[model samples]
Target: MLWEVDQKVKEAADALHPSSNVDHMQNILQDTLIHCWELLLKRHSATMQIDAKFQDLLFRALDYYVVGRLHEMLWWLVCERCQVVDQLVKTRLSHLRHAHLSALQLGVPAHYYTPLPAAVVELASLASVESAIGRLQCVHSTIELIQAQAKEARVTLHQYKDQEGEPELELTKEELMALLTTVVVQAQCSHLVANIYYMTHYVFSVTEDDPLWKSLGLLRNTLENIMKLDVARLPQPAKSIRKELSLQDLMQVSAEVESRFEAKGPSRSIGDITALDLQLHQLTQQIQLSTQAHSETHLTERNSPSRRSDRTMLSPTQDNSKSHSFREFLSSIPSSLRESLRRRQSQQRSAIQSSLNG
Candidate 1:
């Protein structure tokens, strides 16, 4: 089914452009995905063995699927589905929690495992399940954290009225996405993939139409799409309004600013107002100059490397002096004698240098 879908999608796509069908690199990804799916669905214990192979195929597919903003589209689709899964999983887990607790309280073991009398065996099974659950929970937390960050990101992407009172985007849409952000989403998918691999050992003969198989199929499609599409051209939404801020707390500051702009002397003359305006203009220039100077100082400090007093790289002259001083100290020893031992290190150094020069 995976192969048929990919093949038909390709044929339909290639029908428009004849050359599109000639991409030999495309087969590697499709072949690997199909092979992995076959392993997972039909064979026992082989799916786990070929996980690295599946992951490798997905990565290599990146080179082949360099068209139609596919990478960007796949990530967006994957994240959307992942977000959906997160909510569903959370709700499912909440409902299942009491049942699980009650089971533990009643001293019941997890179903699908061979019942044994040994205490150690039961504990091991519980531990294994706990560990697996921990991994899934970690992935859940990652998705939640990403969701929280995305809310703030949406705020940042909101249309803001600029100083000119014209709507402007604070940052470009491209700048909003971090390069490795997709990797976090992929890791979440991998967590599920691994759990499924573990589960397949007990469950037998999952039909192609099974919900579990369908989800895996969808995930595989997502991974495949991530490889081929042109990620750069994914459509970005127009900036939207978040909220309007018209706080009453700014009244005092607003009044002060109005007073500055309209300040006058004792005489209700135009000249006094003119003088005040000149003073305000000079103050603005002074502020700009001060800000520029501070910025330069800050940049210099940030770019310069910090120096340490205790340890530092020495000059060749310093190294030569240190060696000579150490030789002098060694020469002071009676048993060591004067010249030979003292000059030994220096001679060796000189010989090595001469050899390199020669």
Candidate 2:
């Protein structure tokens, strides 16, 4: 049914040319295509798997349709049909394929299985899926390149727009699209492919005393440092706004900015914003060190006791001395309730002294 309808639509389209009577021919072709789509949906609804496969087919097929606009159209269609799946599957199918097997074995669907680590199997499943997103760094680089190119092109075309004579041929929408597509493809090829390999090694290249794994472990502490620096260096938005505003507007501006002020009221300084960025870079180094330490600590915890005891047993005198020392340390400590009360009293005294000094 679909094939016959598609044939009719094609025949109608073939009968028309750019210079021919397009209006009548387009109406006929549109009717044929709409009818074919309706029949296709009817056949799709008749089977459970057919409906699923049709969704997949449309999802993949539309990528080649009208330079990627149809993919969004297919998305709306799937949404209307309530066919949304896991976001990991939808957004990061490539990364999801590389995710731990635990993710794959999650749902109790009939087709689900103990996943094997075969890129081929994952690729087969994803053959009908959209292309994976390019890396962020790639997009960043591409934007920089495009801006640079645009600036250079603008410089070259500066005289063309000023001419008062005949109009120059403007770049067609298709031509501009083709140029942007080239840039996107180049960005994906250059950065995303390289970064994927690097990221894969970072995640999976575990070994004895692996430096890469160590670096990843320390990242959170580095982030903490970054946050501290960022808090300190953040621009005093209110002060800058105040400086730029007239006395008349300052009153209204204060009212507008009041809601965003911190507990201490708006900042009256712009000491340094770059320090935050610098600290972030320093944090990366700290993160690397921390990661190494954590991995080393974990490795020690896993293997330390066995190695420590593998040596000659301690002498009875040494063992007794160690045991005695531990008991003495425990006994020297005050009770938890007493310790808490003592610390609270010390804090209260310090607060009172500070208040007196102030």
Candidate 3:
């Protein structure tokens, strides 16, 4: 099953024109994956009586494998231009980081920017990796940390509500936005847009209910809002501070970090999924275990009143125009195709639950 899917995905990828639009390539990738998935289901259903759980696990492993392989192919196909874009991303992030640190030193409250610098650093680290899966994981982890911080801030606000002498400790929505602005500005990610695009169109297939997908959407909204912010309105660092944080120092630090990452070796790369010794069954088991653990944790959180409230507080107000545009995109998709894709994803989730019990 894995071999067949790989062959089909490779053939589709190889057929793409070198100059094809990224959006067009994304569509082709999705259509190809769906085709392969449907074919696998039909071919296997007749020969063997595999449970839906195993079937879903098989699909997930296949999805991971295909996406990882495509990441490698895309490096040569589209990411050659990404090298130039990455340099620009790095430069922008450097400026933002310097500004953030300067803001801290220049009397801006440290609490206002506490967790955001860590978030930026985490994302900047992800810039070194070219894998879509790697980037997705990094974004997911960063969002989780931020979400926890936001929850803590909310708790602190409630605890100090009646206290007379308490400091202004609550992280308000405006403060959150300001801090997020800093993060969006400083996320030094190479192929950032492409990674988001790839994950949305291919991996999650725009499953809005998925937590990771929702987190990515929130980040996308934050990135879009950057243009609306008045750059001059933001606090300016002292000339001395700006001079102290030289691009040379930034480059040296980045080089040391990259060296550390490299020393850990290619085992961290998504390409490890395609290793000859890693059997499909083993991959399926790993994904199944992970899915089960995640589902259990999600259920526990959903049932917690405090967790529910925290989620409500943490959810950002999305841009209405952007929401409408997304709705329009969904409506533009042929009803039949949308139904097919939705049905497939639903099956994948349901199958995971059913298999875990068995």
Clashing pairs in 3: none
RMSD of 1: 31.5
**Colliding pairs, model 1:** 65-228, 67-230, 69-230, 70-229, 70-230, 71-229, 72-231
Give one digit per residue, the lDDT tens place, for model 3 in 1-358.
6678778887877867778865566557656665676666656544342565555555565566666677766656544644443444344444445444333332434333233456777766765555555566677777666656555543443342333455454545545555556666656565554455545545633345656666666666554444333334555543332223244454454454445545655444332121111222243456557767887554222221222233332223335564454444333323122455567556654563454444
Q: What is the descending lDDT order? A: 3, 1, 2
Least accurate stretch of 10 residues (summed lDDT) in model 1? 108-117
Off by more than 4 A, model 3? 21-24, 35-58, 75-91, 101-113, 116-118, 128-134, 150-175, 204-206, 235-358
**Cα deviation of 211 in candidate 3 (Å)?**
2.2
Which runs in model 1 stand beyond 4 Å of their true positions? 1-130, 156-181, 185-196, 199-221, 227-358
- Give per-residue CA lDDT, model 2, range 113-197, as digits (tens): 1111232222223223322111222233333443344334333333323434543234333332323332322222212212222
**TM-score, each model?**
0.20, 0.19, 0.51
lDDT of 3 at 261: 45
C-alpha lDDT values of all predictions: 0.31, 0.31, 0.52
- Sort by TM-score, top down from the best: 3, 1, 2
Q: Residue 114 in candidate 3 has what lDDT?
A: 36
lDDT of 1 by residue, 140-210 (tens): 33333433434433333232111233323232222212211232222223223233222221112222454
